[model samples]
Target: MKKITPANLVPLLTAALPEKDMAHILNALVQFLRDGGVKRASQRFDLLLDAFKQNPELAREFGTRFHRWLGSIHIYPALVGLGIFSRSGFAREMGIRIYERFMPSFKDLNNLRDVFLYLFQRQNDEKWLHTVSLLQWLSLYDTLCRHSDPAAVQTASRHLEQARLHALEMLSIWVAAEELEPEFTRLEPKLMEVDSAFVALHQEISRLVAHYRSGQTEHYDTAHIAVMMEQCRAQVERLRRKGTGAGAGSSVKVAHLLERLSQTLDRLAVLLDIQTAPDEKECRRHCVRLLNSLTTAAVEQHSTELLRRRSINMLAKSISENTSGHGEHYITRNKREYFAMLASAAGGGVIIALMAGNKIRITGLGLGDFTTAFLAGLNYGIGFMFIHIVGCTVATKQPAMTAARIAEHVEHKAGARALESKLAKLLIDVARSQAVAVFGNVVVAVIVASVVAAAVAAHTGAPMLDAHTAAYQFKSLQPFTQPTLWYAAIAGVWLFCSGIISGFYDNRADYLNLRKRLTVQPLLKRLLPARPRAFLADYLHRHYGSLAGNFIFGMLLGMTGWFGHLLGLPLDIRHVAFSSANLGYAAVSDHSGFLYFLLNLAFVLMIGAVNLVVSFSLALTVALRSRGARIESLSKLIDTLWLQIKANPLSLLFPVQPPAAAGGNGNGGNGSSANGKAKE
Candidate 1:
């Protein structure tokens, strides 16, 4: 007959039983063995164990299956050893009952001890490695039981001492291994010292308990206990620093050991139930300082690594996308349109400036006056035109880019068409709003400038400049001076041409393909090197239109001079003849030409300052409003992305489902998880 041993019974019973039933069987066996029924247990154990002994194949199969079950939770090494003995005759006859009684209770403790020993032993065997992982889990239950029962402190303290001794012995074995060099060798002596200190502490506690049990009063030295804890904390900090400089393998081992040691110390402290002392507080403060230093270093290291990885990953993704067929096409088209618009706007402004300069030079003006007037006119005209062009472009194109990105995100989903529809609507709304704001602002600025000119004409008793110029004939330039009405007609035509160009450029650059195809400033150019020069380049590019607008404003001021002169009003020749001169004359006759010049000077300075401040303030209000809207939109988009991630994390790597569908699933999934079944 086969022997009734712990090893044979364990596999046989656990093979066919569920976890709860297996636990129950082990518990019963432990109780029976503890009751001293070794002989009686032998007969029953042999009958159950024969199935495993009869066929080596069956035994192997059962072992494999049982190991898988044990892997699900922690099991003791002694239990496993006992199970092996159940199949041997001598073991069953001599030690079967004793093994059965103690193995179950000691299972958790033995498993934990084995895991520590395995790390020291440096076993590379797969089976051993798997078994060690299972054992670590079992140790938690062992620690938990001891922590919960105050009355069992004495017993728990004894068990911890034994565990520490086992750990120290294992450390010694590792130190002897040549493969485990300077690091393990250094740690071994320290671990031994710690083990001795802990044992002494345990013994003192035991002595105190024994004295109490013997009806003698005993006082425990809480201060001494606190000092020991402080020492342990200091050791932990030293080990942490050493571990940081150690080789990777040694570092990992040291970190694991330190973690376990910390847990053990915490358990011991709880068992001691030490009261607070002034020195204890000081020790705690020191510990906090040490921990904070280590924690900060680790956090900074982790953050840097994370950022580096993200940057590398983004670059790689961008490179790959640029290489792809569709990606190349999209980029090419986008660049082409972007540059085309920028070139057209800049070229047109240069043409207008050149044209106006030629006309002024032909009028027989001095070089100084011509140069100043040309520069002022060029700045005003170009600045005005550029603002409308760039503002409209940004408003239209930014939304389109955003929409395309969103559409790509949802392209593979079931409701992709619906998503596309919604995105289209959003783009249209953004474009329309932008067009209205740009056009409306331009119209208002023109009207305000015209109204101010009209008011000046009425006050100065000047005929409308347009009327007087029509009647005059300059002998030197009779060919050019057809009529003031003709000049007004020409100005109207130029204004219309400028508006058409601005709108066309703004609309054309809004497409993704067109934006990339224009070689204005590539994303890489913006990204590659940190150059102060590049910032200057971007600034110049963004505000180049403003200079054009300023030139146009100056031209309009010059035109007002002709209107003043044609009305038989005083001319501010010093100030180049503009309606600003009218402000100098409150009394009709006292409005000298020199006073008109001063008036123009003061008005230009005052209006420029006031308009600049008001315009900047308005821009800030617009920017803040836009930021708040963008933040709210981004919040919604982020929530949608998170829902998609949760529904199917793989979707992030490859398109599995649309964001909309995932959002629906997320709401449904959350409801079900919280309330026990998804609604609808």
Candidate 2:
């Protein structure tokens, strides 16, 4: 038989608990051991459970100790206030953190939470606390209740009555707040009467709790209250469905509030169930679920996960959804669409080449680092802005936007097979579109830079780049010898940031009703005719986010080198399209041999690979996480991709033409193409 041992989490069961405070308890914990080492949470639980099964004497002592601690502290707050009804935002929590940093909140034993926290104040407490299953917790709870002192059990039950009342109060407050929120009001203009149901439930539950507390033995009619709860939940569900629709009114705060409302409703249901249960068995089941929930709340309270749980996913969904509409346009579907992408990319290449040349002229001005950076930023920013105005594609900008589009597809809750098939096809199209776009940008950028370099040389009677500068450019391309990949990764991160910035601005426009405001402006009404005013407002409304994104992205890229110089750090950006243009200038000016230039071109492509991999990975992660979807079977998706690649290479590269004209299977996707744009 296994030897009996106390659970690592068998809190307040030792000599330390009766005599010591939290600080002293913490000091004593270091001396606690199992197998001459710290036991894992699961192992410790199994050990304690074994002791309960085999050693009744030790079990009784543990149960008594547990009840003693519980009876001493108010257990209601842990049930009512934990992990439910966070109507307040993160700023309030941040203020609390700041206040706690200077002056802590755990000084007084406010409730059972304080005692629980004080008892298990070790760093690894939450690790074991969270990982333990409901059954384990239930088994322990059942045993403790059975073996605990009758007086202590009676005392704990009284505290539980206060917890029930508080839970009802929280439910009522949340329902009231939801009714007042503009976001929910917009979803249900008629006001779905949830607050009334919650109020009724609150009153009914309060009466039932009182009846139990007053030692009434009559059967309480809670059936009406349960029905009210169902109706309220249905109304909440309807609002949630409306919220998820592809509309303009949705925001992160709304999503968070909706999530919180749903959680509070469920939590209140559990509390209600514990009281109105038809039998002891039913009551125990409800009690077990409540215990598990409080465990989760306790674990999260001690970890950074509480903040993460509050808002990160909601913010991600907002950002991803905002970018998805624009991201769709940045893909090519057919030969016509591919050529259109190429054309747009070529236009971007021309502008980038001119921008690079202007940078050379700007560098020669002998300005300070800050001035150079500022002027260069304007040069790049204005050039990128022009590219956007002209509907041109900068290949490096594709990853950030395209990744968001891919995430939109992944956001579905369809069957895994269907999702995998849909995603695989979309991925192939995105890859094909990206490939041609990059080809157009790199090849055309190199050509334009070469022509401009030769023109400068012919006019000035010298190469545009001096021999010394050309040499430095050459060295910068060698990945093995220099940090070219690192710089490319920095560029990728900036690209992702630009996508997020674009999404954020778009969300702001929607939230602020910027388009509507612009149309109704007092100045515009007097200065311009309605037709022109409407057109101007409409155009800016649709395009403002992208334009802002491009300008900021350009500024980021342009100012990086100057920042590196000023900070004495090795920081810079290396975009694939821009770097290709630089390589072209170096080749033409330095009069380098073909083989060495070709080698450098290969290295530039490697830099492009790093850029795509990093940016796409980051964007994809954010996109997937935002939607709460997991691509569970990677091997299956990889297999599907392989099959597609093997079946029709052309389908993966070019759009599949109609079967009648192409004399082939109808497997290739001939979907409608979105006219591609990106620096655009």
Candidate 3:
């Protein structure tokens, strides 16, 4: 029994082909190229190419059969639209993905689009195609087309030429429309032109393609084609910048469209470059790139991974940018700003303490889980909203907000040294800001809750909490006895989600022009004079997202316990401020001894640590990815941070006295001036 390996298998297949049906053998070879792992496919392809070099007769027989097979199938759709703008809107594309998951489109073997879809439909299929080198890809393609009398091969070239022209025209229109978008126009009115570079570039490329179709041999002037393309590209970048800014109000749909337009321009530019190649060698290299793009594009379009990822990144970046306006205030760059954050967090803590007591009252009412959740949630929501209205900070919510500022800075090109310095400093500010906020919230909340409990007990001759409720609250906060850390992590996730909600609403505020709508609002008109109405509208415009996010976050926190009970799960949130406040009430009401209270206090701090760590890690991960920061840079950042930490550990808990301003007093005067400097 001979063990068949790639070493012997190819020769054996070649010998047996003489006695076998050529059509079946050819189909098997084609299938070999399409399927299997990269190494196996490469081995088989190399073997076939070697066999062809040795025998001309066999090569012709195989080549003719292959192209004849190719000539019979449709290739236009695959060439022109496979990974291009075949799908437009973000919602439509997502719907298509959802539909395909349940009920896929039927594949027609004769159509190249369907055939490509059929061959590489899996999410992981794009990996192998990307790893295949341009030289190997070129070798495989040239071999297939080598012995062709095939009209299909010629038709493919013609289709590519046609696609190039069409892409040029389509890109021009897309660019024109995007530049004319009100926001884009307003952002850069001076960049506009009469013979718009986009339209002119389209005309130039179309002319070049016409020359090739007619077989003209004269030198083509495409020097300015590159210049024109650059102009269009520059404009695209401007729109991207303006679109992602605060109040620019970009959507996933608009972001996706911007990405697709950029891609179309790139592919079109390559096509133009290929035609203007100086020699056969240059032309072949250009052709190799296109050949590689064709198959990779098919695989990508079928997988749809690239489009989905890029669209989401663009949207996430926009969301981060939108919310980052408030994030700057969350970061404290100096001593004055740091103290202000502590004060704000302390204010928030006082309200949270009262809210915790109300939650205790609500829970003791013996209501249904859903009804309990509703009332408790209402209490939480209105309380948090009141805190926001009065200008206070919640430590848990800072991660999502502060992450956007860090992300925006990562995108800046300030040279490697400056970036490292500024980034590390910014990180220090964020860390200290977080520390002070948590310290203020926890300590103040605990103190307030304890004092209130003592006051009630003194007046009413009994503690506010009954024995059972006090015991239950203590049990819930125990880290070792329960999955309390896991619960805290859940609370962190909710905090992150609330931040995203805040950003989305902030973007929507600008997108919907809420202030103008409110100015014309009928209710406002009836309630107040124009001067006062305008002021109220302006205030709501600024705080709309914060108000909505805080309210919804409260609801989520309130509902988790109910949902857990309904599903027979141990799911519940353990936010740090709330847990600390609960501890204060439980200790005072239960009349627990000092030793036992200290033990519970240790657990409360541990819970707070978990809550902050989980929320901050998630927020940072999303923010960095959305900004497309390189892994290399992130590694560098990690190294830089370690150096920074070793040099001055206190910097993470106290202000750095930024080196550039070291000679100066570095007091930062007051909170407002310090805040002005922290803005990116």
Most lDDT-accurate candidate? 3
lDDT of each candidate versus the true structure: 0.34, 0.73, 0.74
RMSD of each: 28.5, 4.9, 4.4
lDDT (10s digit) by residue, model 3, range 583-651: 999899999999998888889889888887887788777877888863346677778888878887877
Candidate 1 error regions (>4 Å): 1-377, 381-415, 468-680
- Which 10 consecutive residues of model 3 have the lowest summed lDDT? 671-680
Q: What is the lDDT of residue 313 in candidate 1?
A: 31
> Which of candidates 1 and 3 reaches a greater TM-score?
3
lDDT of 2 by residue, 1-680 (tens): 44435543344345565653433443354323222244465665666576566656556765666566556666666665666646665555545545654665654454766544544434465555665677776787788778878787777767676667666665655665566678777677756454555456666666766777677877678787778788779877776555543345356567667777778888878877787778866777788888667656654554444565655566567667778767777777666677788788888888888888787788779999889888988888788878888888888778888898887787663465577767777788888878887888888888999999999899999998999888877888889988899999999998888888888777666656677889899999999898999998887777777788889988998899988988899999888887888898989999999999899999889988888888889998888877887687889888888876676678766877446645553325433344544443
* Candidate 3 Cα errors over 4 Å, as ranges: 1-27, 34-36, 61-76, 97-125, 140-195, 209-215, 413-415, 418-422, 525-529, 593-596, 630-653, 656-661, 664-680
How accurate locally is residue 627 in candidate 3, as Cα lDDT from 0 to 100?
Answer: 80
TM-scores, all models, native as reference: 0.19, 0.82, 0.85
lDDT of 1: 0.34
**Candidate 1 or 3, higher lDDT?**
3
Task: Give candidate 2's TM-score.
Answer: 0.82
> Model 3 Cα displacement at 431 (Å)?
2.5
